[model samples]
Target: MRGTVWVASDIHLGEAVPQTARAFYDFLGRARREAGTLILCGDLFDAWIGDDHALRRPPRWLATALDELRATAGALPLWLARGNRDFLMGRALADALGARLLEAPAVLDTDAGPILLAHGDEFCTDDLAYQRFRRIVHTPWIQRIFLALPLGARRAIAARARARSRQARRSKPMAIMDVNPAAVAQALRAAGCDTLIHGHTHRPAVHALELDGRAARRYVLPDWEFDHDAPPRGGWIEIDAAGIRLEQL
Candidate 1:
């Protein structure tokens, strides 16, 4: 094909150390020219809640920056998956952007093959508590209620939720944040896909595995970082006719 399909995830926009806005906008400029479709794995925002298009609240230069991408990416397909953080993205924003919001375990056809895309949280078979919570929260009834809450209320709830999540993460082992190998195999087999793309663990790499009767490849996208106490190890995923490439800013 003549275009590239950009895949990136875990932008985590709310962090204070440094923002990925600059890198993200820079990538958008290049991706618009080369990518026919852009798949955002998940966690596009650091802390997002409510369905209203409150993106006007983006930090001073951020909103204007993103508008440039909208202009350049006109009519290009942008498929976005929701992470634990941005689960609030709803129809209104998708309609405005002319993009599609994909749920977890999304199956897609790419120049590469029939591929599976997900946030990868559901495949963490080891995290029993989180899996249970995810089941309840992702249910249609709970999601509807959450989306219907006033924006301010949703924001407040998200704040508390985030705090608790941080505490839990501290108490849990590192392995709990990663994908389960057996679960990965099972999921790919069910989707009948030979490739999977996901972002959640923040450990970016390309992995190969034999699942079902076929071999499968998994690409783990990375989170963006910036110049702070921690050097900017910012990362992203990109695929073009030349092949797939990943760069750390």
Candidate 2:
């Protein structure tokens, strides 16, 4: 927390993203050597039915990803934050990886300064339908019921939900898919932080603005999609005494 910090998110690692997985493994290796603390902001996987399912029978790709994460955790401090897609990632998975679970919207005190960090989905208040679904799935009782079902049933449900989400996105306007300005301002003000870092929306950039007569910045982390993205895309944010620096691969 007092030295260099590296943050990345939305790798969406899955059976299909072999190239992205390799790239992420490479990033983990680099982070092991160069970063004092590493934070995986969210969506490390495309979907996470449950920790039990993963721990019991991880596929080849997941097993490799877990091994690299465990190695990275052994090398230095590693933290995981749950993303919208991987909201089921729990303490069991974190413990298995030798990493700690970080609650989203955590205020990280770094060498550069204190910054608000999150998976960046809650800020997308404009996506009302998705927000409603988020509320339902986030409900403890609902999650318990879902988790209690057989893994195959859970997988089927998740697949249907994902299909619905994709269809919804196709019909919605681009603006609604991104974060809302008011929501961002409120979060920064409530947290009393000038800098906010998060990943979602897949649009990575640094935005500067004035809030309550004070200058503030929001750093949007990039999503990794090396397999099919035309030019390939992935990146991370590095923070140190030199402040924030964005690195891409």
Candidate 3:
């Protein structure tokens, strides 16, 4: 953290999005060359049933992704955080790439300053249904049961849940899909940090706020979509002793 730290999130890599996979690999290469420490905030994969799938019988795409990740980790300090979609990403995946698993809402004392980092889904408190689903899936016993099932079974269940979630999202209001202001305030207070960085909503921006007569800032990371999107958006946050900046890819 003495040098420049790079952060990005929501790449959503999978077999279907080969373009995105390639773009991410290229980004990893750039990070390896440029960053002192690289942190993937979350959603690096579209769906990660378990690390066993990658370890036991990785498909060609997964194999390539892992290779790129391993190469990057070998060059620089790499950290992976779990997102809602890839919450199953665990020690197995981290160990494979020689990367450390980052706990959400991780506070970092960096060259720029102390900052709070997370996947950003937990702040969507306005989405009650999604919150409930998150709570259910996040329960240790529930996750244990799910992980105990065969990989095929787990994949099928995850697919169905994702489908249902997409369908439900279609009917939900846009406001409900975004983070709650009160939740943000509470998180800032709880973390005792003025600067926060996270990604999940896909709406990227920087915000200024006042908490307890102190200035605060929140940086929302952008999602990467290269296959279907017209422009193929992607970006990362760079932090140095000078300050934090959002850099487009």
Candidate 4:
């Protein structure tokens, strides 16, 4: 990007979290004025059962969120990637907001340099149960079957899955939930990039790694939270000719 590129992920916007929605709207406005390109890495919505839900008969909260996204997209370049929670997001949603759909583990040639971007969940290879669940849900045929269901049914199924996922996380070991070192190494090598950017573990930090006799770095994007937290915690990565830096929102 010419001016500046801004990246963010895991907003998890939903009807239940009005404060988060508003905060995101504010962020969009700021981005329009400050950045030339804005990329939402993933999980922009808390639950995206299907694109049809928002395109056909969107609830009030969804409608408002769409409006904000549309405005931001109109003002600047917007690229969205699929997160675990909102992987159902498709071209229909992207078309509606004038945004481009980004594939996971995409490489971006930015002003700073080439960077690898992803939603981050795929690196948690240690979580066998989650990996199995991901395989099932991500299968093309299974996704088609799920999408063919009635919208109400899909919503119910998604809600149930979310509940079960929460329960499972409670009993799982913390280490399993985080990214596996081997998985990260494999991904970076496959992409042929030294820098990796993603969001899913929600634990935001920068890690320096030695890979294939070369130095590499991984940047974890923060998950946005405004309702449950006391002071509201959120941030984004800003990239320019100088370098990339995380800025608090």
Backbone clash pairs for candidate 3 read none
User: For residue 61, what is the lDDT in candidate 3?
Assistant: 93
lDDT: worst 10-residue window of model 3:
179-188
> Residue 24 lDDT in model 1?
75
TM-score of 1: 0.87
lDDT of 4 by residue, 1-249 (tens): 566999999999998899988888999999999999999999999989889899998999999999999999999999989999999999999999999999878988888888889998999999998999998899999999999999989989999999999999999999999999899999889888888888888888889999999999999898999999877878899889998787776
In candidate 2, stretches whose alpha carbon ends up further than 4 angstroms from where it belongs are none
User: By TM-score, highest first, what's the ranking?
Assistant: 2, 3, 4, 1
TM-score of every model?
0.87, 0.98, 0.98, 0.97
Q: Tens digit of lDDT per residue, candidate 2, span 1-249?
A: 889999999999999999999999999999999999999999999999999987998889889999999999999999999999999999999999999999989998888888999898999998898899899999999999999999999999989988888898899999998999899999999998999999988999999978999999999999998898789999999999999988877
lDDT of 1 by residue, 94-157 (tens): 6666677777777866565567888888788899988888888879999888878877788788
Best-performing candidate as measured by lDDT: 2
Q: Write the per-residue lDDT of candidate 3 for residues 9-102, one digit (tens) a residue.
A: 9999988999988888899999998899999999999998988889998999999999999999999999999999999899989998999999
In model 2, which residue pairs have backbone atoms overlapping below 3 Å? Answer: none
Instruction: Give the whole-model CA lDDT for all candidates, comma-separated.
Output: 0.74, 0.93, 0.92, 0.91
Judged by whole-model lDDT over C-alpha atoms, candidate 1 comes out at: 0.74
Error of 2 at 51 (Å): 0.4
